[model samples]
Target: MEFRNTLEFAQEMDTKDPLVNYRDEFVFPKVKGKEVIYFTGNSLGLQPKRAKAFVDDIMTDWAELGVEGHFYADKPWWDYHERLIPPLAKVVGAKPGEVTVMNTLSVNLHLLMVSFYTPKSNRFKIICEEKAFPSDQYMLQSQVRFHGFNPEEAIVEVKKRDGEHFWRTKDFLSKINEVGDELALVLIGGVNYYNGQVMDMETITKSAKSVGANVGWDLAHAVGNVELKLHDWNADFAAWCSYKYMNSGPGNASGVFIHEKHLDKKDVPRFEGWWGTKKEERFLMKPHFEPMPNADAWQISNPPVLSMAPYLASLELFEEVGMPALLKKQKSLTSYLEFILNEIDKEVDSSFEIITPKERGCQLSVFLHGQGRALFNYLMEHGVIVDWREPNVIRLAPAPFYCSFEDMYRFGQILREGILHNE
Candidate 1:
């Protein structure tokens, strides 16, 4: 962890990285004549090279089979959707039928809300984090309105205590306990997008469910970045976009999970769609709505094969590396990042601060004292890619599939130069 300023140092770290070969699998962006450093997997991940071929296979089927592609061709579009189930289920630690690829993130959230957020007279409030992704907040507010309630009165949000930006698990649990009686649903981001905090979903779900609340998660930032056990953890439901850690391309298709226990529960209501009907019975064109069991019941329409292609490409790679080992690599790489940032700031001693929790995921959210945007733009110009949030915080995530120890080294150079030159 010594401070070194050259790509040679980066090369040395890369040589030691057991997961180094993963870099060759992706298409890195180029700025001018150089390879631009991409550290914003917190936002969008780099595309895998195999993604094109995956898409092309689907295209060929569409051309050859025409209408028959639904049940014919190599993958057979009729059962093609199920092909992704095994891989998606494995990524989230669920049984094969417990997960399904479908819809965008917020759309899936609304559908899940229909089934799980059946608010009763006593347990009539929804709980979530403050400053959740805007789309989620919008969906929750609109859903609250749809249910004949004022969001201001029906929603309870957990924000950092005092002036802090992150909450400890103990504090989070205590807050849940305080509102145990009033809660109907607890929907939390698996990892808070702003601060890079990895919420303990298993612990949180257990705490909430014990108190009679439905538990769900939005794993946009956590899906492939962290190891999840939605089924074993007994999470009632969860949804995620495939674009971030999953690297499925911009606005890629999403996936959802429902514990097997809910498959035949007549009590659970859902927003009905023809696509969700039993496959054999779906083509009958019957008036009755018979749902396919498990998370597949959440599907609203025919699967978008084009979008599913990249997700397939990404999921296959995740299957190869395995999530547990990938996480171990993440901890080491991010720990190195944290250590280097602290070391550089130690010399300046009193100016910059990294506000993210010490045990955060791949992203490190830094809070600049006064100079934030200026420093961020400077880093971009120097080809040290990262992201900036409103007012001050900057997020940098070194994705496991493509990011390298070398990325951290390069950013260190950018950070040192930006801070010193500004001073």
Candidate 2:
């Protein structure tokens, strides 16, 4: 499809878009009394308009039922988290029995490591990508330290080629083979937060297992943004936050995926609590810990219904539109954005080098060559909401659920004007 940098062309594409109406479902923040072009969905998603009502229902139920709300609420707070399973499962391409909602991303990763990151005297090294998200880096460091090992020796980082923006799959495969018997686990972010590159999880997971290593993914950027098959990929475990593309809220709850093969195993080591036990035996407070038959076995506490409410509300949108439709729009919308960027770069004296590779989802991490923070500040003041990384890179994720083609075109215009103003 030929792309144009005109408002009419953008509007025409929106008119043809099947998911265009979803833009209205979210409440965007205003800058100078106009809705800003939000491009930071990779950092935090806009609030779903329906989220307020979902929270209200929980608030009203608590007011009416008091202590009995756990059993008497319309959705029954005791089991509210279960309602999120089916839709959340569908979004991540896993069976309902293989997924559950729980603590935040880092917390869940720590818990999952208890089951999957077992290291022995000879096999103790973990393989991960170079420059992983800070939380993941800290978590892996602490985990290896707790097991009495130096992080420098226990963690094998797959480095990108010098001067390249993204990692090559062959390098990871070669690293796994080099580490060989010493590799105990392979945990890396599915979609790199810095470069927006989607790792080839299926191939990497296969290679990791062949070397007797457990594989896991931190899907913070990948979960709702790209296609995932945690179950089919045979990933031992994975975790993601809901506040990004999932559109829950700031620092909201997270989702977990545990393979069916790991569920209901009494011998599997885990940090257990009452909520993880079988529901029938939970009230009994029995002496033995009988785990849930599914992924909920890893849960350590009762569900936070208030936090889960907004997530459930967002999943309604997912169920209605489906990931397939979202992915289809995402490809076209992102392609149009790339075209707009190229067009703007040609017209301006400054260079805009998109660092995000072709394997990306909705995000485009562009290096603003010959430009500086003044341009980013101008963009923000002019009602363009985007994320600025250290140095001159800006991450723009035009989420398909709410972001429009018009936003991309308008952003290109604002960006061009900002560059010209700075000169």
Candidate 3:
């Protein structure tokens, strides 16, 4: 893992990479007729080459079968969501019966919170990380208000110590202890959206359970990026979006995971829909709600197949590549990226600090201290597709499915020129 900051080294690594051919399966965006160095897969992954055909199949089925497509189409719209369970389970480390593809991320979060976040007289406070994704912060605020509790009193934020960008495991565990018997639920993003720190979900889950509190994770940035063991970790529930690392289309379907222990709990409260009813009893149009005995019990509506087609198409690649292989490339490629950027910082005398921890996925959140947003703009204008957080952070992710080591080298080259131009 001795990374060299040279184009020859990067290209040689690329040539030897067993998964390098995966780059061909995606269609990258172009700027001025050349392919851009795409590093935003942590935000929205590039479209898979097969996505179009997947959508076409859905379109053709709709055209030919109309309403009957639910039962007669090649994929059978009635059961299309089930097609994703195997791969999706593998991605999140859950049993197929413990996972379901449905709803958007926020909506699923709300649904799960409804079932798991109930607060009573003594155990009424919820613990979460400071600076969680904006949506999560908003959701927690509203949920607290909906339950007739003051947000200040009911929501406890576990913040990093002064001047630190990431939360240590002890910091979070201490917060869990501080909350004590008042803690009702512990919810957090598995991988932080801004700093790209992969939280220790196992220890968090066990700690929360020990304190008689429910726990869940929003895996939005972690789903296809890091190794997750939601089932073994005993996370009560979890949810994630597909568009980012999963490489589904924009605003695609999201996935949910519920522990098997919760599956047979008929007494659990949830906002149910017909799709969540037992499939056998569904056709009878029973007035009473009879929930499915698995994670599908959380489904509030039938899935949108067109939106899910690209996700299904993308999951095939995950099935083929497997997470272990992808994670190996992720660690190596991102480490190389970190090394190159550090080398560039030294060469240009610029203060580029990587805020993400070594236990990260493919992303490196570079804190550009002096160079500022001008460098981000310059990189974009020159065809390097990376994400810019407000203030001074640039997020670069080398996705294992499509990003190559050479792309990392090209990015370093562009970034070097950008720093020099700014100077």
Candidate 2, superposed: residue stretches over 4 Å from native = none
lDDT of 3 by residue, 1-423 (tens): 688888899999999999999899999999999999998998899999999999999899899999999999999998899999999999999999999999899999999999999999888999999988999999999999999999999999998989888899998899889889999999999999998999989998999999999999999999999999999999999999999999998988989999999996679999999999998888898899888989998897888999999999999999999999999999898888888898888888888889998769888998999878899899999999989998899999889888888888888888999999988
What are the Cα lDDT values of the candidates?
0.84, 0.94, 0.92
Pairs clashing within candidate 1: 70-78
**Model 1, global lDDT:** 0.84
- Cα deviation of 367, candidate 3, in Å: 0.9
lDDT of 1 by residue, 1-423 (tens): 464546786688779878899889999888777787888987888999999998898899888879887778777776667878888888888998889989899989898999889877777788889888899899989988888888998888888888787877777688789888888899989999999888988888999988999999999998888778999999989999999989999988889998898985545688778888888898999998888866777787989888888888888898888888789888878877877787667766635667778657788888878676888888888887789888877888988778777788777777888887887
Residue 271 of model 3, lDDT score? 91
What TM-score does structure 1 among the candidates reach?
A: 0.95
Best by lDDT: 2
Ranking by lDDT: 2, 3, 1
Instruction: Candidate 3: give its CA RMSD in angstroms.
Output: 0.8
TM-scores for every candidate against the unseen true structure: 0.95, 0.99, 0.99
Error of 3 at 42 (Å): 1.1
